[model samples]
Target: MPSVPLHSSATPIVSAVLAFDVGGTDTKAGLVLSAAPGEVPEIVDIQRFRTALDAQRPGPVLVDFLDGLLRRYATEHPQLRIAAVGVTVPGLVDEQRGIGIYAANLGWRDYPFRAELESRMQLPVSFGHDVGAAGDAEVALGAGQGAENAMILVVGTGIAAALYIDGRRLRAGGYAGEVGHAMAPAPDGGLQIMEATGSAGAIGRRYLLAHPDFSGGAREVLTLAKAGDTVAQRIWAEAIAALAFSIAQAVAMIGISKVVIGGGLAEAGDELFEPLAKQIDQLLSFQPRPVLVKAMLGQNAGLIGSALKAQELLSAASSEPSTGALP
Candidate 1:
């Protein structure tokens, strides 16, 4: 979905479809439906649950969970005929092969996700990366709209980006957006991982490490920084700098026209973007400074992306009217 081209029209489908986005903390499910013919499906009835991944064998466990979910939905929404499924998960994925190559927290490697789901559920399954899916939604209907070249950064528990150049997403075999692991300047004059100094999770974690007595997360840390807490201020500033460095790196390589910031950190509003913009300016020389914008799709972008994939699959397989590909 990330680089599948920007589609703003309807997917040819006559039935309801299931879209699932599996996150580190929770798994989200939604039903997508088109109110009328020739319209994009509206994602509705969103639900979430604690993600339970078995370290030894996540494939079967996930399939079973999905099967149960399908049954529950069938019972709950009996009038609707469920046709296909589109699922997105985090980590390194092979979209073409429909394989989940690796996920450290999800504890899976080289798992045949699409095959297993289709074989078990007897429904067509469209699989992709979670962040990529989110990026797809952002581009299609969210803040990244109308941007020809951009980076959609999702800085949650971890950090990843969805790079769009010339209005096409750069998949790079699902390894394109692992910015959190990229090296950055550290306070100690040594290089540290970007997520260690940035990322919403890292911001709170580093603050807690510095002040064990603190009892809140990144929002609280930002508040403390505003109140002149030196430790909080330092942590916050370093996080911003790390993000700027990573964004600058992306700009240097591809000349992004806009940076759409999403995930938990983006909720900080001006607290994150204003300083991030300033730091990035200080780091750049002659590059076109990219406009920083917040993601408008909230946290359900992946669900929307997945649903779009499901509808697209249905359209491709059936005689439903669809806008095949639109730039």
Candidate 2:
């Protein structure tokens, strides 16, 4: 619900765009209306649907869902012109080719999303990595506004990163920001990757493995840790350690000025940030410690990002330069 009040009820809606964010477990579609002067753009008529997917071949189902939504919106809002469509999905994405290179959760490989969406909708399409697009919104409209070199690190069922360096996003064919896979010291005295040890899903999975009766995720695990459960404490500590190690590495390599944490685990607030900050300080020597902050746009960042993508598409097609700000 990104909204701003218009001054007058008589003012007409200038235009709107269709935006879809295909997340791991759900898909969200909404209409992003362009704001008139002195008003903020808003995402209205939002719909959330459980992602009904076929892991091996997700494109057809996804495309069908999007098309239906688009048609419905068109019928519902006849007054506003929908200029473009933006779709973002989790996975390795090649923005230049408009291909979803791969997604571990969704299990699609090299799917030509832009071509499929364009063929059906007949509109200018913008496609990108889900976390990357969310990062764009954060940079432009949230915590990362003034930073030249920053990162948006999303720790959820899995982990991914969006790198902004030299004041521009680094796609590198969608291979630039897979930091979750980086190696870290495991709590069991061996090496493990950050995602396996630190992600919200990983933390829950680890705790569940330790105590089969515990029917909850990282949140419950954190609660148990605070209540003096040794098993939960160990698991929570490992998650923190793994995350801190990975972040310090990014700071060393890229000199990241700010790391805007997003996704479910960020919901933990101080429990995640405080210890992660302390550990990161312990790890870095010469590298400047990046400022760690929670994402301001919350879960809506990706959706807003999709809207921004659509707006940009329309702007480009009409030969109008886009400022890349959130609509």
Candidate 3:
């Protein structure tokens, strides 16, 4: 876990907020209370629940589960009032509209997520994409902090990126950072998406395709590569090359000063970063090379980001005049 930073001595403490990060397999909830006003909130009562298995009816089930979690939290902490609620979910999310456009893993489509949650909970709701929210947290408090421009890439089952430039997140209507789908040179002398060649899932599939007798995943393939397996080495090298190509392209296009990589594969540490940095260096001529760093927040980044969003909602509401009307 990354160390939480303290606020300046001048600010005072404020109210609490509720936050949830809904993932494909699990949902994490936290109550965030500020140690001081205008400071990073201290997260408390953090809990994780398994996501509903009924994909056919996940929306209602998820909403009910969230309601239950919130109720339990409120009951336990009667002294703390939740000003707003923030929820981050995986998939094609329209944060501005608070609609879950599509989530193949969670099996939902065009769900009015924010409205439903707010209607039931009677609180302001902040909804956003999981990766985007995580990136925001990274920029605000983790690896990408202090950089004027940066790209945070989460390489898990699939690959995606959160682009930050000029002190602002470039959402581009939620379609801007789909780096996995970007075109790259395929092994067969044709164009292919970066995820199809370099993602963890892709690496596993490639290994299986080359050696049908093997029954291991990407981790095993990587171990074999390190131990001098020719096929594993070739597959790993190709994936690295494709990823480097994509990073070089991003650097050329955005002039990002930093690239923070997270997720399971980043655990490889030097093995992944050293080669990737070298490849990117070789690929770029006059372009300034971006420094590559590992993610500092681990898996809790999305949850922290949700808390930040909740705080943002609180701030916005505080600035608005009370109409004696409910949203």
Task: Tell me, by lDDT, which candidate is best.
Answer: 2
Predicted candidate 2 versus true structure: per-residue lDDT over 1-327, tens digit per residue = 978676655546557888889987888888888765323358888889787688656877778888888888888887677778889998899988999998877778888989998898888889988899899888878877878899999999889999999999998998989998888988888998889999999999999898888799999999999999998998999899999998998898888879999999999999999999999999999787789999988888888888787777776766756444332
Model 1 pairs in collision: none
> Considering summed lDDT, which 10 consecutive residues are worst modelled in model 3?
7-16
Name the lDDT of candidate 3: 0.85
Off-target runs (Cα >4 Å) in candidate 3 are 1-15, 35-41, 53-58, 76-80, 211-216, 321-327
Clashes, model 2: 0
Query: Each model's TM-score, in the order given?
Result: 0.90, 0.90, 0.86
Question: For residues 1-327, what per-residue lDDT tens digits would candidate 3 score against the true structure?
Answer: 987678555544346778899988888888987645434557888889897646777788888888888889888877677777889998888888898888878988888889999999998889998889889888888898888889998888888888888988787766778898899999888999998888887888899998998887778889999999999998888888888989999999988779999877788788899999999999898999999999988888888888888778777777788733433
Candidate 3 versus the native: TM-score?
A: 0.86
Clashing pairs in 3: 12-37
Give candidate 1's whole-model lDDT.
0.85
Give Cα distance to truth, residue 193, candidate 1, Å.
1.4
